[model samples]
Target: MADKPTVTIIGLGSMGQALASAYLEAGHRTTVWNRTPAKADDLVARGATRAATVSDAVWASDLVVLCVLDYAAVDELLAPNADVLKDRVVVNLTNGRPDQARRTGEWATAQGAEYLDGGIMAIPSMIGTPEAFILYSGSRTAFERYEAALRVLAEPKFVGTDAGLAALNDLALLSGMYGTLAGARHATALVGPERAAEFTTSLLIPWLQAMANILAPSSAEREAGDREAGDLPSEESPLDMQAAGLANIIEASRSAGVGVDLLTHLLTPMRDIIAAGEGDVLTDLVEVIGKEIRS
Candidate 1:
């Protein structure tokens, strides 16, 4: 078999280690560096080379992958070695905001390195597996050049040319996930801990999945600019009725000695939409949210 391309990984955190391991397992010459050199012990034993310094790591390979704590840490580590980064393709898988990713991309460009901001959707254990997927944006040329190597880690999804695009989508997806988590916690609290496990497995998971399926078409309607055209029949429960149902949830939680905070917070926006006289169609809530975001 042909030897794989060499890859350098900075930051030996769990995710970073997973990345290096994936590359190594794919037969790439993997060079790894971390602030705590001892963290690379196991990787070194696994045939990964340990770089003596951050600059050495950058110099080790043309494809440098960074999976650090944040954008700040990324800057702190790479800023001094900017000169060494020239002609390298630096792929940052750091978790950060869109603006931060854009700024870092600019900095990398200034140092003559091609930049691609990436968002890993899977956890460490899923690395190198088909279950893992990664979102990437910016430096399309670089992405195409190294995409084969990247696919060794996970499925590479090139989102757009904008450096911030991956981060934006990443945060948006995570926001949806956290919202579901909050809803699950509220549901479990109302049910009591004793039955929460069974409730989640047998009921909550399936119900939430069904609810998601229902919302999918509504989302498509909104995207297609059919907000004025109610996705559901007018005979269906209106926004006001939905708000009342939320109110009932809050009351029931309070009565059951469970915290009503999540339900209360959720209802606030629905009430705001109603007060703004935009609750005629259920999808009007989307417009209300867009307005609030713009304001």
Candidate 2:
């Protein structure tokens, strides 16, 4: 087998430090740099080389990972180091928009470097665990070259060649997570906090696990903007029944002195669709939203 590649981590935030630690633990030569030099002290103590500057960090490794604040910070750190970036592979795990990823990919390519935009799907604590997986897009060759090294951080998922694909899917996954959390919060509010722990553990977890298993595949299709009307399953739960249940939920929440904002946010558009005489099932809303997005 080939020798492990040296890895350079360009940010020392919690996530950046985790990445550096994983690399160091895997016995890769790890170099780390942060704007505030003090942040790298712990990692340096763990056998990581602390680079004095961002350019020096880039120069230390063929695989340079960036987990900085944003695209602006990424650009600020990288622009000055462009000369040294040639032939190197840059993996940016920063949170950013799809367009920003595309633009950054272009900029990196112009600098004669291979760019792979990354979407980290786990928290810092989850890095290096089986539960953590990262999405990558752009420069398939670069990804293939460093796939083994990258897996030291998390399972690597290559989404596509479009630089923005990773960011797009990342935001989509986060949207699902926030939506799930909102519903869970509303459910907990329906029960008092005293009961939340038991409710979530005994009822909510299994219920949601089953629902997710049933819904996730279809949700994936809708999210990809590829769902056609015919692709929707036969109406298992009609909107009329759903609307009645939702109305009852709203009434109960109001009676319990709980806010109905989240429920109403769903019900209002739902009622509008039903009133507009354009929808019969809940999934119909997907078509309407798709059209709105297209327009």
Candidate 3:
């Protein structure tokens, strides 16, 4: 019924521009900035004001939306102008680490500013959709203060006040995505690209999505340990099949003159599963996979 809010968005890359577009569409006065300057031209054409510099961008609004490369970039760019950012609610939608988040949160607080570390769960095109799972962690007060501006990007998923949970969760989800990708790469090679697309689009996508949904809850399930005490869904995928599948890729790559190092590295350890005779259970091969690579 009225003007939504005045927001400043820095780093006008694909994701950052998408954020600017969403805010503009939602009736917020959005001031945008980018290193190249030309990157913000399109956003400028969309009724968004392009700030002269990062300092001006920060000075333009009560909320600063940072959707940049990573947390390191945030520090490198904002450190000099930290004084201008004092007391502004900074909603960092950049990909980063939990430790980095805590460090950044402390730095922002020291400068008399508020910070919220956010993890984006959607692609650039899905910016304003409800399925875009946006994660925010940090000061609850800061998050509440700028919740509306955050919503201009995605379906805001508030992870808690821990200041690191969002990054941790973000990393976990990314690991799963990469894992699924690894499997697909191998499968495409095994089945041949011609047939790969058909199998992948029709079967792989749905199958992996279902597994991912199941695995989301199963992560907690395995932690609680009431579901018969074991590893991942071994009975379904099977360790022997998976092991053979991995081996087949390694062999095929050699024959096809392609590098299969990643495959070997990922699947080589599973030889123990086959040796242990639990090759029928896909879950048993994962006694060594740790939290470090899940995302």
Best by TM-score: 2
User: Candidate 1's residue-wise lDDT over 1-295, tens digit each?
Assistant: 1556789999989899999999888889999999999999999999999999999999999799999998889989998998998999999999999999999999999999999999999899999999999999999999999999999989999999899999999998898899899989989989999999999999999999886766545655668775444244343667888889889998898899988876675577778888887665566656655765776
Better of 2 and 3 by lDDT: 2
Q: Show model 1 residue runs off by greater than 4 Å.
A: 1-3, 218-235, 291-295
TM-score of each: 0.90, 0.91, 0.84
Which scores better on TM-score, 1 or 3? 1
Best by lDDT: 2
Candidate 3 minimal-lDDT segment of 10 residues: 286-295
Model 2, 1-295: lDDT tens digits are 1399999999989999899999988999999999999999999998999988888899999899999999999989988888998999999999999999999999999999999999999999999999999999999999999999999999999999999999999999999899889899989999989999999999999998887765545765678776543444437767777788999999999998889987786676667778877778767757545655665
Residue pairs with colliding backbones in model 2 are none
- Pick the winner on TM-score between candidates 2 and 3: 2
Model 2 poorest ten-residue lDDT run: 225-234
Report the number of clashing residue pairs per model: 0, 0, 4
Q: List the residue pairs that clash in candidate 1.
A: none
State the TM-score for model 2.
0.91
Off by over 4 Å in 3: 1-3, 213-225, 228-249, 252-259, 273-281, 291-295
Residue 254 in model 3: shift from native, Å? 4.5
